[model samples]
Structure formats: structure tokens, C-alpha cells
Target: MIPSRSDWTKALEIRHGKSLNEKFSKSTVAICGLGGLGSNIAISLARAGIGKLILIDFDIVDITNLHRQQYKANQVGEQKTTALSNNLREIAPYISLEIKNTKIDEDNLEELLLGADIVCEAVDVAETKAMIANEVLTHMPDKYLVAASGMAGIGSPNEIITRKITKKLYISGDGVSDVKNSIGLVSPRVMICAAHQALTVLRIIAEEFDL
Candidate 1:
């Protein structure tokens, strides 16, 4: 059986302190893409008791995604948005979740990300990443954007670090590695970058600015 909301947050409150837990429980986060990076980031935030999540992705799980993504082998044919939502609900039943199984473009991106306090860019394509960063920085100035740059290949995990770009934009990763030129994405390095993004979001919610 699922635990009560108060019971569920009681442990998180102990770990995060009541004040921080309250902040986490009141914030809404939006994650774009549900691939390796996005999936790991979503799992981390859900476990942290993020109040609401807007999951946007248009892909379906494939057998290949099992290696680095958060999906199970049995969910290969399922839509990513639905699959991730199911997983998040199992982990944090009381948290609010919003999912969109459609591609986010210049037209609909703003509306999809409307209620989010923070936006996470985890898309694989470089152009898409740039578009998301530009859109959020230009139009949604009030929202914090945590994006990844270079987490591909089997590089040293320590290379993945968060950088504050502007007052509202933060980037995480080595800022050099690209999958097109590298050997490929390794599970650990991708997860390290995802963790950095997740931690940056948490830090923003906690009002812990690194600057």
C-alpha cells in the first residue's frame, strides 16, 4: 500500500529539513526528453519529493534504451511519457505529475512549460538543446533552466560539473564531449551529468546559489 503524504514526506523532511522539504514540495519542474539523461533526472527529482513534474517526450521505449535509461526491459514498446509517469507514481505516489506525449516545438514549448518553476533540457540533438535554451532564456525569463552540454563517452565522471551561465540558466557536463565525435555515451557518465542537473535544480529550489 502507498503511504500517506505526511508519512511519505516525513523521511524526506528529516533528510532535507522541514523548510527545504516544504520548498521542494511546493515547486514544479519540467523535464524535456525522456532518454538517458532525462529519465535519470526525473527519477532523482521524484525521489526528492518535487511537488509536480511536467514530462515531455514523444518517443517510445526501445530495447536499446534499457542499458542507460530508467525503463525496464518489459516496457520497450511503451510510450516514454507514460512509462516514466508510471515509474514516478510508484516511487512518489503523492507527487503531482503532468505528461505530454508530443514533440515540443517553438509554438507549443512555452505553453507546455507554462506552470513549471524550472525547466530541464535533456534532449539529445544539439539543435533541439539550443532551441530549448534560447526559448527558455528569451521568453521564460522567470524560470530557471538547467541544461546539459557534454556527457557522452567514457570520460572521467568528474568532468561533469554544473556551471552558472546567467542569472537563470545553468549548464551541467564537460561542455566538450559530443556523441557524434565520441565513442558513445556511457551509462555512468550520463548519469553523472544527470545528477548534476538534478542537484542544480534542487539547489535553485533551496535558494542555494553558487555565484
Candidate 2:
């Protein structure tokens, strides 16, 4: 049986302290792109008791995604938004989720991420990443954005670092590695960047800023 909400939050309170856990439990985070980086970031945030997650991804899970993404073999043909939401519910049953199984572009970006306190960019294409970052930073001035840049290849995990770009924008990853120029993405390196993004969101909620 699923645990009661109080019992569920009690555990997070112990690990995160009551005040921090309350903040986490009240935050809404939007994750764009449910690929390796996005999938990993969603899992981390959900596990941390983030109140709601807005998951946006237009792609379906493929066999190629099994290597690094958080989907199973049976979910190969399933839509990423649905699959990831299913998985997250199993981990954090009480966590609210808003899923959009459609591509996120300048046109519908704002509406999709309307209530998010923070947005995470995990798209694969460089152009798409730039567009989302620009849109969020330019249009959604009030929301915090955590974007990744260079978690590709088998680079040193330490190279995956988070940088504060502005008051509301933070970037994670090596800022150098690219799949087209490198040996493609490795699971560990991708996850490192995602963790940085997830932690950055938490820190933002906790009123911690990087100087």
C-alpha cells in the first residue's frame, strides 16, 4: 500500500530538514525534453518531493533510448511524457505531474510552463536548446531556468559543472563536449549534468545563489 502523505513527507523532512522539505514540496518544476538528461533530472526532482513536474516531450521511447534514458524495454514505443510520468508516480506517488506530449517551441512554451517556478532544458539539438533558453530568459523573466550544454561523450564527470549565468538562469555541463564532435553521449556524464541542473533548482528554491 502507498504511504500516507504525512508519512511520505515526514521522510523527506528528516533528510532535507522541515523548512527545506516544505519548500521542495511546494515547488513546481518544468522539464523540457525527456531524453537522457531530461529523464534523469525529472527523476531526481520527483524523488526530492517536488510538488509538481511539467513534463514536455514530443518523442516516443525508442530502443536507442534504453542505453541512457529512464524508460524500460516494454515502453519502447510509448510516448516519453506518459512513460516518464508512469515511472515517476511509482517513485513519488503523491507528486503532481503535468504532462504535454507535444513539442515545445516559442509558440506554446509559455502556456505549457505557465505555473512552473523553474524550467530545465534537456533537449538534444543545439538549436532547440538555444531557442528554449532564449525564450525562457527573454519572455518568462520571473521563472528560473537551468539548462545543460555539454554532457556528451565520455568526458570526465567532474567536467560537468553548473554555472550561474544570470539572476534567473543557470547552466550545467562541460560547455565543450558535443555529440557530433565526440563519441556520442555516455550515461554517467549525462547524468552528472542532469544532477547539476536538479541541484541548481533545489538551491534556487532554498534561496541559495551561486556567487
Candidate 3:
């Protein structure tokens, strides 16, 4: 069963503090890409008590995604955001969720980012990821960006470094790896990157880590 607000408050108090939990429960985050990184990050944020989430993804799940993504194999062929939304609701029923089963582009980028306290770029495509970064940094300079890159293939876990791009932008994962090389991805590395992204989101929300 989903935990109640008071239960969440108590848990946070035990884990962090009441002040941190309050900040987390009041923040809104938008996650672009419902694949491996985005899926794990979104679930982590929801379980941590983020009050609202806006999830966007254009593709449907495939058997290949089951290796790293949090969705079940039965969800194959279903829209990415839709399946993730169902999963999150099961985890945090009291939280508000918005799912956009469409591609994030110049046209709808603003709408997708509207009212989002922080935007996480977990998409796979380089072009779309760069576009979102430029759009967000240009229009909403104060908003935070937690992005993942070079998460493909098995590499040194120490290679994944979380760095600040700007006062409002942060990136995690190795800088050299690429999906084009067919480096491939396994669950461990993807989840590591996702954890970094989620922790960055939490830090941003709590004002503990400034850009």
C-alpha cells in the first residue's frame, strides 16, 4: 500500500529531517525519456515523496529495454511514459503525475517544461538531449538540469562522475562512452547513473547542492 503523508513525513524525519521532506513534497520535476535512466530516476523520486512529476517519452517498450528499465517484460509494446506512470502510481499513489506520450521537440518543449521545478534529461538521442538543454538553459536559466551521458557499455564505475555544467546544470556518467559504438548497457551501470541523477534532484530540491 502507498504510504500516507504523515508516514512519509516520519520516514523522512528519520532519514533526513522534516525540513528536507517538506521541500521534497512540494517540488515538481519533469523527466524526459522513460527508458532505463529516466525510469529508475522517476521511480526513485516518487518513492522519495516528490509531490508531482511530468513524464515524457515517445517510444514504446521493447524486449531489449527489460534489461535495464524498471518495467516488466509484459509491458513491452506499451508506451514508455504510460507504463512508467502506472508503475509510479503503484509506488506513490498520493503524488500527482502527468504523462506525455509524445516526442520532446522545439514545438512542445516549453509546454513539457512548464511549471517544472527541475528537468531531468534521460533521453537517449544526442540531438534531442542537446536541444532540451539549450532550451531550458536559455529560457529557464534558474531551473536545474540533471543529465546522463556515456552510460553505455560496462566501464569503470569510477568513471561516472557527477559534474556541474553551469550553476543550474549537472551531468552524470562517463564522458567517453557512446551508444553508437554498440557498447551496450547493463542494469548496474544504468542504475548507478540513475541514482546520481535522483540524488542530484533531491539535493536541488532541498537547496543542499547549489547548481
Candidate 4:
């Protein structure tokens, strides 16, 4: 069951301290995909006390996604936005969430995600991923973006690293790995990339905001 507001606050205070808890509760994040990387990154941000989330995706959960994505067997056919919101609300009951159950394209990009404190590009297709990353990084220069290049298969944990692509865009992953017949997406490596993205968000919004 989800904990009470006071109970949740106490837990977050213990982990992130009092000041960070306040800032996190006021921040907003937009996740452009709802796959392995996006799901995990959104959850991390929720747990860290982010106040609002803008979740966008057009895909539904599939059995194949179980290995790496954050959905259950019962949610096999549910929309990714619905499934993720259900899970996130259960964890962070008080978190405010906005869901866009649609596919992101160049035409709707700006309208879909505007005024977000941070944006994450976690789509699977290379073309869509690149498109969103470049658009957000170049157009929304003031906003921070976290993009993942590669996180397929069980390889060296150290291989996944966060690279700063620009002043506001950061890429996290091995940078070369791809999903193929020989290698598949695993939770460990995917989470590593997501971790870097999540932590970097915290660093920018909270840690360095005062600097």
C-alpha cells in the first residue's frame, strides 16, 4: 500500500535530507519514452520526490518487455502511459502526473512537452531518439536533457558512462551497444544508464542550482 503523506515525507527526508525534499517536490520532469530506460528513470525521479511527471508514449506493454521494461504480466496489453502511471502512483501517491497517450513527433514535440524542468529521451528507435534529443537540446537550450545511446545485454558494468554531449544535453550508456539477436536488453545495464540520468537530474536541479 502507498504510505501516508507524512510517512512519505519522513522517508524522503531521511534519504535526501530536508532541503532537497522541498526542491524535489517543486520540480517537474518530462519523460519522452516509456521503455526500459524511461520507465526506470521516471521511477527514480518519483522516488527522489519529484513533484510532477509528464509521461508520453504510444506503445503498449508486451511480454517481451518484461525482461527489461517496468511492467507486469497482468499489464501485458495496457498502454505504457497507463501502466507506468499506475505503478508510479502506487509508489508515490501524492505525485502529480500528466499523461500524453500519444506518439511524439516533430510536429507535436513542443506542444507535448513545454515548460518542463528536465526532459529525458528514452525511445527505442534510433531515428525518434535522435530527433527528440536534437530538438530538445537545440530548441529548449535552457532545459536539461538525458539521452541514452546503448544499454543492451549483460556486459561490463563499467562500460556504461554518462557523457556530456552539450551544455544541456547528456548521453548515458555504453554508446555503441545495440539490441540484436546475440544480445538482449537486461535490467542491470539498463538501470545503470537510467541511474546516471536520474542522478544527473538531481545534480542539476538541486545540487548545482545554488552554485
Candidate 5:
């Protein structure tokens, strides 16, 4: 059976204190991609007891994604947001999950970020990433967007650093590698970038740092 509310309260009190739990449990986060970095970051946030998650991805899992994505080999043909939402629910049954099986574009960008406390951009394409950033900056000025770039191959994971672009936009990762690199990706570097993105989400949720 699932743990009771009191049980969760006791656990939080002993581990993170009431204020932190309250802050995290009430925040809603939207992850704009369910690729290598996004898959891991969404799961981490769900497990951390974020109240709600909005997962948006317009792609299906492919065999190539197995190297770094959190999904299993059997999930190759599944929709990315659907697969990720199922996995996150299995890990944290108490958290609410919303899956949007469509790409974030100019049309729906503002609507998608309307109520999100924080938005994470883990999409790999440069044009799409820039679009999301521009949309958030132009329309949703109050929300925070944690974006990731340069998580390809075995580059220096230590190079991943969070930089603030404005009062509401923050980016993390190497900021150098391009998708054209032939080296391919492994789990360690991807996980490091995902962790950085997750931490940025947590910081936004906790109100410890803005942007």
C-alpha cells in the first residue's frame, strides 16, 4: 500500500524539513522534452515529490535513444511522454503527471507554460530550443526555464555549469558540443547534465534561487 500523508510528513520532517517539502510538493514543473536529459530530469523531479509534472514530447522512442534515455529496450516504439509518465508514476504514485504528446511550437508555447512553476528544456534541436527560450522570455516572463545543451559524447562533465540568461531563464551544460559530433553519448555525461537540470528545477521550486 502507498504511504499515508502522515507518513510522508514524518519522512519529510526528518529528512528535508517541513518548509522544503511544502515548497516542493506545491510546485508544478513542465519538461519540454523527453529525450536523454529530459527523461532523467523528469523522473528525478517526480521522485522528489513535485506536486505536478507536464511532460511534452512529439517523438517516439528509438533504438538509438536506448544508450542514454531512461526507457527500456522494449519501449522503443512507445511515445516518449507516455513512457516517461508511466515510469514516473511507478516511482512516485503520489505525484500528478500530465503528458502532452506534441511538440512545443509558437502556437501552443504560451498555453503550455501558463501555470508551470518551472519549465525545463531538454530538447536537442537548436531551433526548437531557441524557440522555447524566446517564447518564455517574451510571453511567460514570470516563469523560470531551465535549459540544457551540450550533452553529447564523453565531454568533461565538470564543464556543466548553470548560467542565468535573465531573471527567468537559466541554462546548464557544456555549451560547446554540437549534435554533429561523431563520438556518440554515454550514460555518465548525460546523467551529469540531467542532474544539473534537476538541481536547477529544485532550486527554482525551493525559491532558493530565481532564474
Candidate 6:
């Protein structure tokens, strides 16, 4: 059944007030990946009632992703964008989303990410994160990015933190872990970092905390 407007956002409206809800409902977020950090951040943003979302990922779901990402076993082999969309739609039936099943690179980053108020850098590799961060942080005046690092393993959950790298760039995680053979991403620590990224995005939207 389609949820009524009141039923859909009753709690959010009560907690955040109408103006904040309106602000969130009018902002757009572009999530550049659908891995553990990106997927969970996207889920939190949808739950927060962001106005629009741009989802981009080139990989297909794999069994290995089940431990860290938001994907399920049944979704294996499906494109990440498609699988994530299916899940987001279930929680927020009317959330606006744009899915791109293509890998992001310097060639098309600016064009593909246009109109986003905030961009969440959820990709795994250090090089890609630095590349995107350099571009978004240096050039975009109105755009902001939340990136993650060192979220692997069941480390101290308290260690997963968000710190402002610049006026427009925020990095989340313990800032030490890497997915080497002996160490790897775990669901709890990864999700904790995802929450930091998601909350940072929301705070950026809220415009309450000075970046």
C-alpha cells in the first residue's frame, strides 16, 4: 500500500521540524559507489528523506560482498545499481533515484555528478578516493564530499570517526585499516563508518555545522 504523506514522514517531521524536513527533501545526493560504505550511506540518506539520489556503480553483486555491503545472496550477479535500487525502493517507496551502472573516472566525473548538493565518495581504492577528492574539494564551491578510510576489521567501533579534511571534504573511519590478506572489511566497523559518512552528509545538508 502507498503510504500517506503523514504516515511516510510523521516521525521525521516531529523530530526535525518542517523546515529541516523541507531542506532534506529538496537536496540531492550523488553516491559514487555501492560498496559497504556507499551502499549503507545511500540507505541512511534515503531513510532521512533526501529529495533525490544519484547512484553509480559498475560492479555486479558477488557472494563476497554479502558480509560488508547491503546486498543479499539472491542479488548475486545483478548489477550493484540495480540491486541497491531494489532495496532502497522497499524502504522508501517514492524516493527519487538515478542509477548509473558505469565506473566513475576523471573523464566523466564532473558531468555525471552535476546538480548534486553533496557527493559521497564510497569507492574502495585509495587512488580513486584521492582523485575524486582532489577534484571535488578544489573546484566545486557548492558541492561537498564525504569519503571513508580504514574501515576494515572489527576494530573499536568508537575509533570510526569523521573529521573535516577541508571546507568541503569530510573523511570518516579509523584511518588505519586496509583490506589486506590478514585484515579486511567487517560489517560492524564498515557500517559504523557508513553512519559517520551519512550523518556528515546530513549535517552538511542541515547547514548547521560550519564545514
lDDT of each: 0.93, 0.92, 0.88, 0.87, 0.84, 0.88
lDDT of 1 at 125: 86
Q: What lDDT, from 0 to 1, does candidate 2 have? A: 0.92
User: For candidate 5, lDDT tens digit of each residue in 1-211?
Assistant: 8787678666765766788888888899999988888899988887777889988899999998888888988888999988887888777777888778887899998887767989999887889999998888787878888998787777777887888777788889888877687487778888888988998888877776754
Over 4 Å off, model 4: 209-211
Model 2 C-alpha lDDT per residue in residues 1-211, reported as the tens digit of each score: 9999989999999999999999999999999999999999999999998999999999999999999999999999999999999999999999999989898888999998999999999998878888898899999999999998888888678887899988998999899988889889888888889889999999999999973
Candidate 1, residues 166-206: lDDT per residue as tens digits?
A: 88999999999988899888889989999999999999999
What's the TM-score of each model vs. the native? 0.98, 0.98, 0.94, 0.94, 0.93, 0.95
| Poorest lDDT segment (10 consecutive residues) of candidate 3 | 1-10
For 90-175, candidate 6 gives per-residue lDDT tens digits of 98887899988898888888987999999999998778988998888777777988888888777789998888877778889888
Point out where model 2 deviates above 4 Å.
none
Q: What is the lDDT of residue 31 in candidate 4?
A: 94
| Clash pairs (backbone) in predicted model 1 | none
Deviating ranges (above 4 Å) for candidate 6: none
Q: Which candidate model has the greater TM-score, 2 or 5? A: 2
For 1-211, candidate 4 gives per-residue lDDT tens digits of 6578999989999998899889899888999999888999999999889999999999999999988888889999999999999999987899999999999999999888886888988888989988998788778877888788888878898999888766787788989888874368888899899988888888877756321
Q: Which 10 consecutive residues of model 6 have the lowest summed lDDT?
A: 177-186
Global local distance difference test of model 5: 0.84
RMSD of each: 0.9, 0.9, 1.6, 2.1, 1.7, 1.5
Candidate 1, residue 50: lDDT: 96
Candidate 5 regions exceeding 4 Å error are none
